[model samples]
Target: MRPTDIESLIGVGRPAISSDGAFAVFASSRPDLAADRTVGQLWRVDLAAGTPRRLTRGVHDRSPRLSPDDAVVAFLREDARGRAQIFVVDAGGGEPVQVTDQPGGVTDLAFSPEGGRLAFSARVPEPGRYGTVEGRDAAAEPPRRITGIRWHANGLGYLDRPAQLFVVDVPATDAEPFYPPAPALDEPRARVVAGPATQLTHGDADWSGVAWTADGAELLSVPDEIESRRRDLRDRVVAIAVDGGAQREVLGTTENLSIASVDVAPDGTVFALANDVGEGGVDFVAPGVALFAVEADGPRALTDAETIDLGEVGSHLTFDGDQVLVQDRARGRVRLLRVTRTGAVSEVLGGDLEVNGHAAAAGRVVASVASPESFGELVMVHGREMRALTSFGATARERGVVVPVEREVTGRDGYPVHGWVAVPEGEGPFPVVLQIHGGPYAAYGVHLFDETQVLVDAGYAVLYANPRGSAGYGRAHGRSIRGRMGTLDFADVMDFFDAVVADDPRLDGDRAGVMGGSYGGYLTAWIIAHDHRFAGAIVERGFLDPAAFPGSSDIGSFFGQEYVGTDPARIAAQSPMAVVDRVRTPTLVLHSERDLRCPLDQATRYYAALKSGGVEAEMLIFPGEDHELTRAGRPQHRVQRFDAVLEWWSRHLPVG
Candidate 1:
């Protein structure tokens, strides 16, 4: 599909299934709604009648969870700063009660089983210790100064606060500035009650997907080991006590499983979709949407499917009182599977099930389906009758256009490098945009356009390839660029470009340009430094100097240790800064000012070096944005980002 076509079919929002299976909620960016932009709102679909009704008029609501009694729907709403806040609206749709007012916002909310409380994740507030906290909050009897001497040690240097979890009363709707009493070393006590927030699995490790036990006394969370020792580290599920006690490793590392989507069965069976790389590499690894029951022994894998990889993002295994609902990624669609304890997964419903949330509730089964072309609908599984319960058009639009064409490029080692040739809908021999993806570990799967589509629509031939060090294919291919970043990865692109031109003479390789964010951005910088194949390039939020990142970025140590080995010297060797002097391409260094991952200094150094060497280069900084530049920036800012990229590419690779 062309970028404009992809934009037009920005399909349904992610559907979420409520606890009771009575309602399903999802978001859509339908042009039929307010603006053509993505507006995430909550919707309730009746599982019995299969009728979906829009609830919560808030424009950008997401991640809806139904209360146990089905009376309330708790969701996240974007505030002024675009930080998501937890909001609660009635099932019938009413004024949303803002539950969380934290600075960073809340995500993945779970209502207490008794329905009297809510547990969610929020960035620990770092209210800076400024002037004496005198008359600020009326919630405090006598407004007092909030101070922390060692807040900086915890990375709260800018703020006079510490990182922690907070629990307020259920409908804590009253906007009151209440600062908890600071912890005194003499009588140190955590402000966030462990029992309330379930501080299981301590450390600064980022935690997500918290699911409460049946009794609500415990919780389940999947946390990625943020240390970053491996390229593709898999997350594991752990059980934590609500009382902030010890955590149990319910899952093991042997599985090499990154639990993508998880659902707890009615009988407490935890079903998860995993990229089982246990049998050596991802190629030999079975791509499984397996059913595992948590036992005293550990997780017992049950699904018998072999090699069929489940779509990690949209795929989930929701347990009905009797069966489980899952989206069949192997089939490029969603399916309703009824799995018995005997390990039989029955296909109850088939075809493309388009809905957003696991947001359907009924007696035994809950269903949701989503499509890139339409708004996801709540599906009802009643005695073999499957139907959509809601109507939501796809949210988010695409301004770029692209046509996917497969091309095989030979790498430096004579290995075939696979890629897709995405040409915007226009005239012949378009100026090429050599777009690289991040992850140096992730893949540019299938044909979905978000940012690059815009570039193609701007009349550019885009080349996206898996040059090695990318996942999905296998470990050998995934690890090929471990120590040879610019070497093999760069060759993969060169080969892919040559093959694309060889296969299609219409591609104008002479006017080719390059751009990428993160690792891809790193490659763009490396490409300009190593070769002059591209006319111009935009290095978005890239890591120019690996040496500087370790001290600043949260996972600095990991990035250096894993990819380049445990030596800082080795990291410097593979980093783009090591060869910045050779760059000749007109490069636009774009970065976020507050990016915690790559940091802005990388861009600053690259820009400074390029200008110092008289290289044609410019730098654009997005304030208040982290690693994500265009994805999370303000709408106007995002548009400007596309404009800047197009302008840069247009200046170099003039389309005619």
Candidate 2:
């Protein structure tokens, strides 16, 4: 596929299955060039016949949830004012009615077991402001107040408002509604209301992942500490009554485990994903599934074999009988697995395909799968057999996309390293680009990556590997480079690249370029500074100085202390800014203006240093964007980013 074809790709997410096993609903997005934006809509698929149809067409819609009785499908949609609110439609298809019109907008939502009430999380605005700045004159607006360490986030900017849980009653069919439904228009519409939402939690903590028990007595949620003392931020599972009672901690307090997501079974069995904390108050261990009896005893590790790290920390957990199903990232691919209450783990479906999102109900599992050749599609898994439910990426596949070849390389320390190489279509010896993934803790999967494909299509070979600090390679492998970020991980990357160049005859090692973002960006900057073998480098949203990061970044207070420790000398030695005078290669620095994780000051400091040393450097700052620029940025901006990278590489490394 061509670079411009990026706009045509359809993005699918968060599939939810009805309790009766009749149909499934999911959120999807496609380019709307006329509006200069991507439009998100809800779609449904019949499980038995494998037929799919669109349900709701809104400006932006997502997070679909099917009610218990399978009569209503509730979802979140952005209104004309760009505020997200809950909307519901009939299962058979009809006009959707807006349920809640909160000012701050809802972040996450879930339907109660009885379908009588909907529980959602919204940012609690200050008194009398109602979570909005609308209708107030600018001169009369109150001054902004800041009282917390995490006053801002990456994507959602300033955190003046704190997220809290709320409950709203679903309008009864025969009862008089607060807001009457609008006349059925040709296009989809929402019934705007004044007020019906009742606040439940009043604390300063951020509550997320709201799940209700089978009896609908209490709502289970994960509360994250966001105050100044964030180093003590261990997530706890809290139970809040549906009738506005006191909230109590359920688990993850005494053991000091960092709990993330939680799920409750019909029999009061609770399953959660938690990471063990070391004596230093850092979660250096890999996360795994933990089981809690709720009444008998506290949480216990279900999988302690050292091979299982619950793939996505925030992945949804579903209980089927006595087994809990979840998606896990193993090696480079994501697979669906079933973990029994007895701690026996088995893979239900395993392959090179990446499972983005999944939902299970009534003994059926549906997931959105993608690979190197295909962008994304919906598939239903039945034991070993699988059925395709949607053709989301047929056009891209038919047009012939590049597929990566997997290879294993030995690290300098004699450890196994997983890597992939995607060469251009016709090649003798091609200029190579070493791409690195973010999250020194995250791995590069065997999936359809837009950046990799674009690089290959631009007549360059792209190579990526899971270094020592990457996930899915077991706990020890992930934590090996925690305190020594640039020492061991850097060696593994350079060794892997050298091995790949030696094994492949079609790779031109002399004209190599390096690029990465986040943690990968840190490595790219480090590589060019230490070993000057590359002709060019692209550093995007990377951390440069561990000393400056502790005060500037959103997670600044604990990040340096947990990853690099408290030694001032060691922190300075590991920073790329310390060795800026050693960098001789031309570099392109890309950063988001509002990025809170690494912050824009990181790029500014690095760029100033590079220029002062007479190194060829350029910086591009994308406005109104955060750290997720490459993945979920605007369609126009994404295309522009790809074009800029291709142009920069072509000019610096001349492939002819």
Candidate 3:
């Protein structure tokens, strides 16, 4: 796939199964090259027919939810002003009825057990801030009085506004139409007359993961302490009475645990996903979130934390009849796992696939799944078999231009390092480019990632690995480099590259280029400065200096401190800028103008030091973009970045 093929990629979201298990609904998305934006539409499938039917005509409709009786489909669509608003459409077909008009938009839409009420969340801006004052723009508004440490985030600018829970009546649709008997186009569509919505949550905290209890008397949610988490990273599950809006703590994290998602069973059994943060306040290393059953006493672990990495924080967790469905990341593949009442876990779907976004009902389970050969596609599991429901992602793998072959090697302390090597067609000792993933916690999975595809099409072999610090392999592997950033983690990366090249005769180790973003960028710069083996390096949004980060980055307060602590000696030892004078490879510093995660100062400082040290270096900054540029940036910008990367490789590590 070439840079142009990036526009041809297709993706599918999680499926929402009907209570009766007769049908399912999901959102299908594709890049609109002409508009340079992503567009999606809702599609429905009759479980028996197994054929998908278009359900909505909106340009970007998503987050589909099937009403209890399956008469209407409640979904979200961005309004003219780009704020997501709730809309309801007949399940069979028809126009959508607009619901609430929120100031900051809405998200996390949920329908009550009886489908009488709709619950959603939106950030409430301060009295005169965030466009709350009509006719007043953000720039013209009063300056904010800073008080919170977690005030901003990448992709999302200043986050002074707190997200609160809201509930509104989901207007009644035509009595009940189980699946068939479509509604006529001329017939009047269901209308949700705007009524005063009840704000069920208040305070400085953000309320998310909204779910209604079986009796519909109360709502269950996780209240995040946006301000106090920096002082102590912890959260708890709370139950709010729907009538009076009074909240009471259902359960709080014990010792080193942090709450992710929670749900109340019909019998009042509370289930939650809790992350092990070691001690609540600091340790930012990648820790596995496990399933827990909360009772009057305390929370009980339903899944092992040592070996099972239950996906990431806030992963899907729902209670099916006699079992619980959850997403787990094990062996680098994100799969849907089923846990029984006895705490026994087994893979129900996505065994060899990267899966997420799941819904289960009447013994039928549906999830959005992907493989190395495909992007996200809807997959379903019924009775004893799992099958793919869509084939839109087949074009993503193209015929033979790109092939990613799995590679493995033994790294530091004899740890088994895993990765993949994608070689272009008709390659002879192709110039190899080693790509590292961010998160130090995020792993390289089986998805058909567009970046690796674009690189191989440009006639360069790409190697990406899940080194020691990556998640999926377990908590031990993820926490191995907590206070030793430049030690074993770096050794594992180098070992993986060296071993892969030695095993594959087609990979030219000498004409190599190392590149990555975020944590990956930090490691890339650290590698070149320490080893000087690469001919070129591209460090994008790297956390180059740990000392200065504490003051400038959105996550600065605790990011570096969690990595190597606040000790000056330890920080300098882990920072690449401390050894910038030692770099000898030609480097391209890539960053965004508004990346609050690493900030623009990191790249400018690193590049300046490289130039002053008599080394070849260039800086490429994308204006009006954030830390997620390569992934969720403007289509034109993503394409332009690929072009620039190919151009740099042509001038430096050109293919033989």
Candidate 4:
């Protein structure tokens, strides 16, 4: 897969099925190389017809949802100015009607059960800020008082503004749609879609994950409450009555475990995918998100602690009649699993594919699945069987994208390590790239990974492994490296890499290059510093200095303390920056200018250290990009980075 091939890559988001199980709607997107941005549209597939149909002409439509009556399709769309708002169209397909003209734009929206009202969430900036007439630009606004650490977030800069819940009544007739001018957001719960939508939430808090009860009498959402400022990813689910828009019932901490997402059954039973803490904070690795049923009686575990972890990344837990549906990750493949109140867990759809997401209604199910050779595609689930509902990635597959051949080897200890190698089409002696994944907790799974495919296309054998400290192998493996990032995890990585290189004659050990991002970037630096087997190394957005990382990164407070340690000596020992002088291999440091996850200082400091120490090194930074540069940054940036990487390798460790 060449860098430009990504322009044809397809991404299918989570599926939203209709109440009657007749059809499913999802947001399908792809990169527009000419525009340097992503273009998306809503699509619907009729179960009976077994075909997919385009439903919208939007350029960035997402979060496609069907009304309870299946007559309306609601989704979020970004306008010409890049501000998102809610839009609704007939299920049969027609011109969409804009429902909200929110200034900050809507982030999440859901249709009420009665189909007369829509509940959504949007950021509310101070009256004089965020493009308001009082202050067209943030620079012109009054000086803001800094108060909390969570005030800033990656991607969306300064998050001091509160995001509240709102309700808008859809026009009952086919009359012209009403879109009121946004009002000042000075008061709590002030509606951004003022005049048309009624405000439901207030205060300085942000509300998200909005859902409506079956009766449409109340709405449930997770609020970024006070405790969240001190506690990472902390949240409390609240139920608000729609009548008075005042009555609220707070569901406190779920048995001390933080909730990632929650879904309410028609009977008021709350099913959630929860984990240890910190929501998805980088440091909250190891423990898997378990399924829980929260009710008046108390919270009950519905997933087996010994072998269940419904990954919370996209696990939109939902009620499929008496059974609950979630995406569970085990042994690398993310499978859709169903659980009963009695703790009887069964796999609804399991295979070598990663079930990115799943949704079911009226006994019918649909999911977005990805394999080792595909990014994402839609599938219909029928009683443990899955059938292709879309051929989105057929082009890549037909182009002969190298599929990673899976392998497992025993580590230094008795632990068995798992990984994969995608060999380029060549004869013998292929230069190798050890691709490390970010998230000391994340694993290299049997999914189509762009990094592996891109490197392999350049005639380099890529070895990407999920050593210890990676997920999908269970919490034990993940927790092994907690507070010891460079210990067992590093050993496991080396052991697996060495084993694969020794067994595969196609791989050349001397010409090997180590490269990774985020945590992977850290490990790459760590590998080149401690072990001098590589001729070149590329560290992209690495977590270099732990002590300094606690404040600069968004998840600073909890990430470093939990993932590394409090001991100064241990932190120094594990940090690559602490031992930068030991590096011998020529290296390339790539970073994003606006990266809040790792920050640009990490790359700058490391590059300065390398140059000062007389090591052959270079640094490249992408403007206006964040930590997700490789995954979701601008298409142009991604292609440029790929080209830079290939050039770096060509100069240092050219393929034989």
lDDT of 2 by residue, 329-392 (tens): 7788888778887778888777878777888877788887777666677888776788889888
lDDT of 3 by residue, 331-365 (tens): 66887889986899988876557886888888888
Better of 2 and 3 by lDDT: 3
> What TM-score does candidate 2 get on C-alpha atoms?
0.94
Candidate 3 lands at a TM-score of 0.94
> lDDT tens digits, residues 1-656, model 4?
88888866788898889888888998888877898999989999987666888999888898987787888888899865679988888888887877887778898888887788899888887777777574376566777677776656788777766788888886432445545455657544533332477788888887877788878888888887544355455456788877777656556653456677877786667777776564343336566688888777766777864467777466787678888888877777888888888988888888788887778987778999888767889988777567888988887787568878889899888788888888988676899889999987777777777787888888999988888888787788778887778888788888988999999898888788899999999999998899998889999999998888877888776788787778999899789999999999899999999999898998999999999999999999999999999989999999999999999999998975
Poorly placed runs, candidate 3 (over 4 Å) = 173-193, 228-230, 253-256, 398-401
- For model 2, which pairs clash? none
Q: What's the TM-score of every candidate structure?
A: 0.73, 0.94, 0.94, 0.94
Error of 4 at 310 (Å): 1.7
Error of 2 at 586 (Å): 0.3
Candidate 4 Cα lDDT to native: 0.82
Q: What is the lDDT of residue 67 in candidate 3?
A: 85
CA lDDT for candidate 2: 0.79
Per-residue lDDT, model 1, residue 586, is: 88
Single out the weakest 10-residue window by summed lDDT for candidate 4.
Answer: 186-195
Return whichever of 1 and 3 wins on lDDT: 3
lDDT of 1 by residue, 1-656 (tens): 23223334334445556565555665544322225345656666655565656687776777777677767777888875666777777777777776666555675677777776777766554243232243445344334443311112211222222223333346633334234667677875533211233334445445666666777766677765333233345567877677755577778766666676555665666666665655332222223445665566766666643433344455555656656555443322344556666666777666533323343345534455544334244456666676655444333332223346666666667798887787766457888888888877666654345565666666777888877776545456666777667778888887887778767767887888888899899988888888887788889888678778666665564465556665766776788988888888888989887787777788898899999888988899977667754544455456666778777777788887
